[model samples]
Target: MAETNDILEVAKMTISTSIKCNTVRGFIGWHSCDNICMDMHDVLDMCEDAFKRERYQESLEADTYVLVSGVKLASCADSSSGMLTDVIMRAFELIDLSTQTIAKLDAAMRKHALSLIIKEAKKKAFDGWDSWRYELLEKAVCLCDEKLAAKLEKLLDIFLEDIENDYMPEYKRQEDTILRYKLHRHLKGADAVKDELYANLYIREMCIIAVKDATDARNYNEAEKLCLEQIKKEDGRFYRNTPEDWNNILFDVYMQSGITDKQIEQAKKILLLGNEGFWDVLKRLYQSQGIWESQKPILLKELKQCKYSVCYRSVLVKENEKKLLLEAVTENPYNLFYYAQFLVMDYPNEIYELCANYIREQCAQATDRRLYKKVCKDLLQLIKWKGNATAKLLVDEFKATYPRRSALLDELQKVEKKL
Candidate 1:
C-alpha cells in the first residue's frame, strides 16, 4: 500500500509537463491508480502501457475516455487537439477492438467511480447496442472517412470467418456473438416489418432464438409453442440440410427439457421428419410408440426405406425385423451400412461374412473411386467400432485386390493403428 501511494505521489507531481510521459512509462511495469494523467498524449500513452501490462481495467478507463473525448473535443471549442482521433485509432489497432476488453470496461463502470468522459463512452458504446460490432463500425467511421468505414465493414463481414493465425479464442467468440446480436435485433425490427419474403427469412431464425431463449429459461410451453408454430408454418416442407433434418432442433429441445409424454405426438411428428434416418430421435420415437404387435408391415417398409435407420436397432435383434433386415441387405447391398449397425448388435460373425462378401464383390469390380472411397470409409468405421474379424477380412481382401494401388494401400496403412 505504501509503495503504490508513493508511486501515485510521484505520478501526481509529473501530471502536466512532458515528464508526465515518464509517469505513463512508469505505469507500463507497475500498478495503475486514479488520476494518472489528464493530458491527451499522456492518457493515450498510459492506456497503451496499461494494456501492455494486461491491466485492462485501467487501460479501458483511459482508452475509452480518449476515444469518446476525441469525438466530442474535435467538434467542440477544443478542436485544437483534433489529433486525439488518431490516438484513438492507434489504441483500437492495439486492442483489436476486443469484445472481452469492452466487457471488462462495462463491468468496471458498474463498480468504480468512473470519469464523466468514460461514463459517456460506456453509454455510447453499449447502452442501446446488443454487442460491439456497430460500436467498432462507429469507431472506424470516426477515425477515417464515412465511405472508407463502410467499405471496411463490408470487407470485414465477408472475411470475419476467414481471418486466421490469431491465438485468442475470445476474439472469435466476440465476433460470432456480435453477429448473432446484430441478427436478433435486425430480425426484431425492420425485418419483422418487411415484405413477405424478407419477413419469412427471419421465421426460422426467430423460431430458433425463441426456442433457445425459452429453453434457457425453462419455459417449456413457450419453447414447444414456438417449435410447433415452425412446424405448422413449414407444413411438411421441412427442408433438411446436409446431415440434419430441419426439425432436429425441435426434437432436441424437447428431449433436453426432460419433459415426457406417453402420447408422443411430438415424437411421432419427429419420426415423420426422416432423412436416411441415422439419428437418435427416431429411437426415442419408437420407444414412445410402444411397437405394437400390429405395426409389422409398416415396420418392414420403413426398415427397407430408411436403410440407415436406427429407430428400431435395439429391438431388431429380438423382433421380426431381423429377417427383413437380412432380406433388405440381400436386395440392396448398400443396405449393409445400416444392416451392419443392427447386425453387429447380435450377429457380429454373420455380419463379418456379409462384410467379407461385399469386399469381395467390390474388389472384383472395375475401379469406381467414389464408391471405393465410401466403402473404405465404412470399413474403417466398422473396424474402429471393434468389428475385428470383419475389418481384418475386408482389409485382407483390399490388399489382395488392390495390391498395385500403392497410394491407396499407404493411406489405408496410415489408419492401421485404428485396426
Candidate 2:
C-alpha cells in the first residue's frame, strides 16, 4: 500500500508537468502540432475538467497553475501581456464556481488568483480603453467574498489613480471621465448617470458615447445638437482635419427621421467631403422633392468648387456631362486612358490624339521596366477601345524615340504582339 501510494504521487506530478508543457506549447503555437487557440483550450480544459468532477480546489489549482505558467511563458516569449491576461481570465471563468461555492473556497487562494489576473491586465499600456479589463475585474468582484470584493474594488480605484498621472493631462482627464462614467453607469444604471459635454478633450470618444446615449433615448434634437456642437468644437482646432464623424451621426439621424431637407443637407455635406455614396442619396432626396432640375446645377457648382471632390468626377460621369468630363480629362491627362472610354464614342479622333500625345510623354520620361509596362498597358487599352491604328502608331513612335532603351523595347514588343 505504501509503494502504491508513492507511485500515485509520482503519476500526479508527471501529469501536472505534462499539462504545463502542453499549456505553454498551445498558448504560443510553439510546437508544430500546437496552435495558440488549441493550447489555450488545453489550459481551460484542465480547470473545466476538474470543476466538472466536483473537485473545486483542484479546479482553482488549475487556474492558478495556468495563470502563473502563462505569466512566466509571456516573459520568455514575445507574446503580449494582454494576451496572458485574457488567458488567465478565461481560466478563472472556466472554474465555474458559483457565488455559493466561491463563499466556501479558501479566501486567500481566491484573492491571489483574482489579483494575479488583474495585475497582469494592468501590465498592458493604458490606452484610455482599459474599461474592458476593469469589466473583468468587476466580474471578479462579484465572484469574491465581500472583504475580497472591497479589496479588488480598491485595487481598481488605485489602477485608475495610476493612469490619471499619465504625462498627457488632457488624455488622462478625458479617459478618467469616460471610465468613471462607465463605472457609474454599471453601478447606478445608465439612466442615473447624467450626460456630460466633452468639448475640450482632443479625444472625442467621450463625446461619441454621449451622442450615442442621447440617440438611444430617442432624443433626436439632443443627438443632433451634440453632433453639431462637436463639429463646431472640432472646427476651432486647426491641428486636426474636419471629423466626418459628426456628419455621419447627423446622416444616420436624418435617414432614421426620413427628414428629406435634413437628408439633402447632410448628404451634400458628406459628398463635398468626397464621400460619393451620398451622391445618390442627395439626388434621390432632391428628386423626391420634385426640385432635382433646379438643384442639379447648384450641386454641380459646389462639387466643382471643392477642388479635390471625388463626387465631382462621379457626378459628371453619371450626369453624362460629356463636355465637363472631357475638360477634366484634358486638365489631368494622367486620367486620360481611364476617361477615354467615356469620351471615346463622342470624340474618337480626339481620344486617339490624346492617347498618342500621352504615350509620347510617358515614353520620353519612363526609364524603368515598370513604367514601360504601364505605358504598354495603356496602349493595350487604346486597342481595346478600337484605337488599333493609334496603338500601332504609338508603338512605332516609342521604338524610334527610345531606340537605345532595351527595357522599353522589351515592354513595347509585348504591346506590339498584342496590337
Candidate 3:
C-alpha cells in the first residue's frame, strides 16, 4: 500500500509539474494503465502541451478519455466549447482545415504537412451520430463550411422548437422516456463494439420515469404493466443496469399494484438473484407483511452480493440482530463500522470485542503507519463510545501490539481525555 501510495504521489507530482511546464517527453513516457486516471485533470491539463508539440493524435486521445470516459459525461451530447473544442482546434491547425476544403479547390494547397493525421482518422470505422470524434469533426467542419453550419444550426433550432411545442408536459415526459430508450439502445450498440457506456443508468432512469408518470396519473395498473414490460425487455443486459434498477422498479410495481404474499416472495427470489440498491424496498416489503425477522437472512445475502454493507444499515445489533452484525464482520471487519457504531451504546461489550478483534487483526497485518493511523483513530472512536475504563483495554492492547506506532497512541490519547 505504501509503495502504491508513493507511486501515485510521485506520479501526481510529476504530472502536475509536466502540466506546469510543457514537457511532452515527460508525458509520453510516464502515462500508462496505472497513471491514466491517476488524475484526469493532470491528463487533460497536458492537452495544450501535446497540441503545442504538434502531437495531434496524442492530444485527441487524451481529450477523448477525459471527456467521454463515463456515461455521465458521454450522455450530455452538449458541452459546446470545452476540452473537445480545444483539441479539435489544434487538430484543425495541424491539418489546415478550412472552408476551402469544401468550396475553393486552390485552398487544398494550403494543407499542412501534418494533415495526414485527419486522413488516417477518416479511415477509421465510427458513426457520426455516436462517435465523439465525429462530433468534433462536425464542429471543425463548421469552421470551414459557414453556409452548411448555418443550415445545421437552423435544423437544430427547428428540432428543439418541435420538441418544445410537441406536448409541453405530456410529450416532455414521453421524450424523457424516449431519451432513456435511446440511451438503452445506444449502450447495446456500444456493447457491439465493446465500449463501456453504463447502460443501466438510462434503464433505471426509464423505470423511474415510468413509475413517476404512472403514479402521477393515478394509474397503478398501467404503471405495473409498464414496469413488467421494461423488465422483460431488459432481461439480459450489458454490465451496467442490473439488480438496483430492476429491483427498484419491480418493487414499486408490486407495491402499487397491490403487493401480495406471492409477489413479495417472488421479489425476494429476484433479489436473491443479485442486486444493489433495492434492499430498502425489500425491507419495506418484509415489514409490510410483518415478516422482517424471517426475511433478514435473505436481505443479508443480497447485501453481501453488493459492494457495501449498507443494506444492513437499518438493522440494529440486538439479540435478534447480533448474528447479522457478526456475519457482516466475518465478511469484512470494516462492516463493524456499519453496525458496530450503532451498537456502541446498548451493546458496548459487542462493540469492544468487535473493535478489539478487528484492531488486533489490523495491527498484525498493518505495516504502513499512514494507513493504520486512520484505523487507529476509528478504533479510538469505538473505544470512546464505551465511555468507561473498558476503553482502557483496547488502548493498552493497541499500544502493546503496535509499539512503534506513536501516532496511533497519540490518537488514542487525544480521545482518551474526552472519554
Candidate 4:
C-alpha cells in the first residue's frame, strides 16, 4: 500500500508538471509562436530529473503540442480578432517555466500540441467580446492597410450612427445641469461626436462651439448660420434682458458675413432697447455699416435725455449742429448759448431768426449777456425781415441792464440803421 501511495504521488507530480508545461507552451505559442522553438529549447536546459525521466518527456510533448496549436490559431487572426489573441499569446510566452523538461519533449509532438493549444485559444478569443474592440479598430486604421482601414472607417460610421440615433436625445433639456452632463459625455474631442447624433443637442453650447470653430477656420458662412440660430432661439428674451450680448454677437456675425445693413439694423434694435450703455456698441455698429449719418439723430436723442453733464457735453462737442442740439436748446434754454453758437455755423437766416425768437422768449424770463448776444446777432442778420422791431426791443432791454457800455449801445444803434 505504501508503494502504491508512492506511485500515485509520482503520477500526480507528473500530471502537475505536464499541465504546467502545457500551459506555458500554449501561452508562448499564442504570443510568439515564431520564437516558440527557441523559447522551448531554453526552457529544456533548466529541468534536471525531468529531462532524464520519461514522465518529464511526456509533459514536454504535451506542452510542445499546445504551443504549435496556439501558433496556428494566431495565424488566422484578422484585425478585429487579433487583439485578444495577441494578448493571450503574450501572457503565455512571458510566464516562468522549467527548461530541462521542455528539452526532452519530442519536437514533432511539441509542434502539434502547440497547434492544438492555439486552436483552443482561437475558439476562446472568438467566443468572447473584447473590451478594446473600439480601440483596436482605431489602431487598425493607422496601419496603412487599405482594406483594414476601410473596414474600420465603416465600423466607426455605424457605431457613431448608432450612438447618435439610439441614445443622444436623453440629454436634451432646458436645464443647465442636464445640458452640461450631455456635453460632457457626447463631446469627446475636437471631432464633435454629437454633431452626427442630434441636430440640436445642448443647442446653445453647440452654437457657441460651432461659431468659434467656424470663425477660427475663417468659415464666415458657417459662423453666421450658427449665430443666427442662436438669435432665433433667443426670441426677444435677448432684447429684453441681455440685449448687449445678443447685439454684440449678432454684430460680429453680420460683420463677418459682410451683411452691413443687417448689422446696423441689429444695432438700432439694441439702441431701442434703451440701455444707455449700448450706445457705444451702436456707434461701433453704425460705423461698421458706414451709416453714422443716420445714427446721429438717435445718438443726439439719447444725449438730450441723458442726465449726466459729461454725457451731454461730450455729445455736444462732438456733433456741433445735430438737429437734436436745436431741439434740446428749444426744450431746455439752459443750453441756449451753446445752441445759438452752434446754429451760427449750421443754419441760415430764416432758421437763425426762429432760434433768435426762441432765445428772446427764454431771455425775457431771465436775461444774460450770452442770450442777449444771440438775439442781437439774429436780429442784425434778419433786420430786413419784419422781425427787426422785436430785436430792437431786446437791444433796448440789454441797454437798460448795462447802460455803462455805450460802445455796445452804439453797435445796437448801427444795427437799427441796417434794419
Candidate 5:
C-alpha cells in the first residue's frame, strides 16, 4: 500500500507539471489518447483538486507543465488553429523559465509563431469573419510592444490598401455611391478627398451637401450661392407655380440669410399667389411686417374656405367676418353659445334677437338635465345682458325641461327675480 501511494504521488506530480508546461505553450491537447496524453478536464480537475488539498507545490508544478505542453503543441500547430498561441508564448516569456530553456527556442520558431498570427488574421478577413477579425485585431494590438504598435500601424495601412484595392468598388454597388463616398470621407478626416468626391457626385446631391456643409461651417455667402444654385436647378413650374413650395424655400432663405424686411416683402410677393393655404403664411408674414389689419381680409377669405363642418364651426367664432359668424351660428344653433359670448363683447344689439331665437330653439330640444342646464346658463346670461322680451319665455322653458334639477331651476328663477 505504501509503495502504491508513492507511485501515485509521483505520477500526479508528472501529470500536473506536464499540463502546466503544455498550457504555457498555448495548445489544448486531445481529450482521449494514450496514457501519456491528458484529458483537458482531467488536467483541470487535478489542478483544482491539488489546490483544494493545499498541495501548493504540486499545483504550481501542474500549472507549469500544462502551460509548457500547450506551448509545444502551439509551436507545431497550423496557423488556422483556434488556440491563443501568441498570448501563451508571450506569457511564457514572463514565466520562470530558465535562460537556457528560453535561449533554446530557435529564431524560426518565434518567426513562425508571428506569421501564424498574421496568417490567421488575413484568413479571418477573407472569410467575412467580423467577430474573429475584431477579436484578433484587438488581441494583436494589445500584445504589440511599443515597437510592434508602430509596425502594426503599418500593417493596418496594408490592410486598408487590401480593402480599397479588392473591396471598395465591389462594396459600393448602389446608386448612392457618391453619398457613400462623402460619408466615408467625413469619417476618414479627408476634407480634400470629400471635396473631390463631392465634385463628381450627382448635381442635386452635390448642391445639397455643399449648402449643408457651408451652413454648418457658417460660410453664409457660400451657403447662399449654393441655395440659389439649387433653386435654379429645381423645375420652375413646380417651385414657382406652387405657393407652398415657393413660400417654404423663400422663408428658409429669408430667415437664414437675415434678408431685410423690404427683401422679405419682395420675396413674399414672388412666392405667395393668394392660395387658400397661403393664409397662414400671409398672416405670419404680415405680422412680421406689423400689418395685422391688412391680414384681416385674407383671414376672412380663409374662414370662407373652411368647407368641413368641424373647421367651419371652430374658425367661424374667431373670424373677422361677422356675417359668416352669424350665419354659422344660425345654421348650428349650439354654435350660438360661442356667438353669444362674442356678441356680448363685440356687437351687443346686433346679436340680441339672434341670441333670443337660439335660446328658444335650444330649450325646445333640451330633453336631458345636462342639455337643459347648458341652455339655461346661456339664456340667463343673454337675458341679463340685453333684457330681451323672450327672457320670461326662456325662464319657463328651463323649468319645464329640468323639473328634477330643481336647484338649477331655482338658480334661473333667482335671475328672473333680480330682473
Candidate 6:
C-alpha cells in the first residue's frame, strides 16, 4: 500500500528516467504480454478485486501510477502508441470509479491526480502531440472541480483555434480540424454541432462522423444533405472523379429511404469509382425498375471509359464479354496469364499465340535471375493450359538466344524438364 506522496515521487522519478533513457518499462507488467487487450482487461479485474477486499487506497495509487506511466509511454511509443494511450484512459476510468470511497478518506486525492494530469497535458501540448494533449485535457476536466473544469474547457477552446497561416502542413491542419470537431461536440452538444460539422465537411474525418451521426439519429434528411453537399463539393477534385465514400453514404441513405431512382444514380457513381459490389446493386436496382436492357449498355460504356482499369476489366468478366476481355489482353500482353484461363477454352488457339508471344517478349527483356525465373513461371502457365508445343519452342528459343547467360540457362533447363 503505497502512500500518496510515495506514489507521486515514484511517478516523477519514472518520468525523469524515461525521458533520460528514451525507453519505458511496461507499467504493472500489464503490457508485457502478447495479448495486450486481454491483459488490460485483467487490470480492470484487479481493480474489482481491490474493491471487494476494501483496499481502495491500493487501487487508487496503482491506477494513478499507471495513468502517469501511460502518458509518458504513449508519447514515446511508435506503432502501438494509440493502444498505450488507451491504457491511460482505462486507468483514469478505474480511478474515477473508485473516487467515491477514496474521497471519503482523503478528499484531496482527486485534486492531486488532476494536477498531475494537467501537468502532463501541458507538457504534451508543448511537445506538439496536440492530439494526445487534447485527450489528456479532456480527461483532466472530468476529474477536477467545477472552476478547474471550466478553466480546462477554456484552455481547450484556445488550443483548438484554427491557424490561418498558409504554410502549415496539410496533415497538421487535418489533425487540428479533427480535434476541433471533437471539441465542438463536447462544448456545443451533439445536435448543435451538426451544422458546424457540415460546414467543415471538407475535412474527411468530420464528414464521416457527421454522416454517421445523421444516419444514427434516423435523420435521413440531414444525412442526405450532408452526403450530397460533400459529394458535390468533392466533384471533379480527383481527376474529375466522384467522391466514393460520400457517394456510398448517399446510396445507403437512398436505400434506407426507399428511393430507387436515387439509389440507381448513386450506385453508378460508386461503381465507376471501383466498388465492385455496386455492380450487382445497380443490376438489382435496374431490374427492379424494369430498365436493365435500356441501362446495361450505358453502364458498360461508362465503365469502359473509366480511368480505373481494374473496374473495366472486372466488369468485363462479370458481363462475360469475351471479346472485350480479348481486346484487353491484346492491349496488354502481360495480362495473358490472367485472362488466358478465362479465354483458353473458347479461343484456345488465340490464347496459345498470346502466351507464346508474351513469353518471347519477356525472354527478350530478361536481364537478371529474377526476370528469368519469372519467364519460367509464365512458361509453366503455358504448359498448364496444354500449350506444351509453345512452351518447348520458347524454351528452345531461350536456350539459343542466351547461351552464355548462366542464370537464364539454368531457368531454361528447369522449364525444359517440364516441357
**lDDT (Cα atoms) of all candidates against the true structure:** 0.50, 0.65, 0.48, 0.47, 0.49, 0.68
As a TM-score, model 2 comes out at 0.65
Give each model a TM-score.
0.36, 0.65, 0.39, 0.29, 0.34, 0.66
- Candidate 3: give its CA RMSD in angstroms: 16.0
Q: What is the lDDT of residue 107 in candidate 1?
A: 39
Predicted structure with the largest lDDT when compared to the true one: 6
Question: By TM-score, highest first, what's the ranking?
Answer: 6, 2, 3, 1, 5, 4
Best model number under TM-score: 6
lDDT (Cα, 0-100) at 79 in candidate 4? 23
Worst 10 residues of 1 by lDDT: 28-37
Checking candidate 6 for backbone clashes, the offending pairs are none
Cα RMSD, each candidate: 15.6, 8.3, 16.0, 30.1, 22.3, 7.0
Candidate 5, after superposition: displacement of residue 103 in Å?
A: 48
Q: How well is each residue in 66-140 modelled by candidate 5, as lDDT tens digits?
A: 444444443443424334344334323322222112223454432333343445445422334333333333333
Count the clashes in each prediction.
0, 1, 2, 25, 34, 0
Per-residue lDDT tens digits for candidate 1, residues 128-190, read 221333344333222223333344445446435543643544454454444434433433543
Global fold similarity of model 6 (TM-score): 0.66
Q: Indicate the TM-score of model 1.
A: 0.36
Q: Which stretches of candidate 4 lie over 4 Å from their true place?
A: 1-188, 194-203, 239-244, 275-419
lDDT of 6 by residue, 292-349 (tens): 9899888888887887677777788888988888888878774668878889888888
The better-scoring model by TM-score among 1 and 6 is 6
Off by over 4 Å in 5: 1-250, 257-299, 306-335, 397-419
Task: Please give, for residues 137-240, the per-residue lDDT of candidate 2 as tens digits.
Answer: 44454345556555555665676576646566555455455555554555456667664434323457666777777777878787788778877976833221
Candidate 6 segments exceeding 4 Å error:
1-120, 123-126, 135-149, 157-225, 238-244, 290-294, 318-323
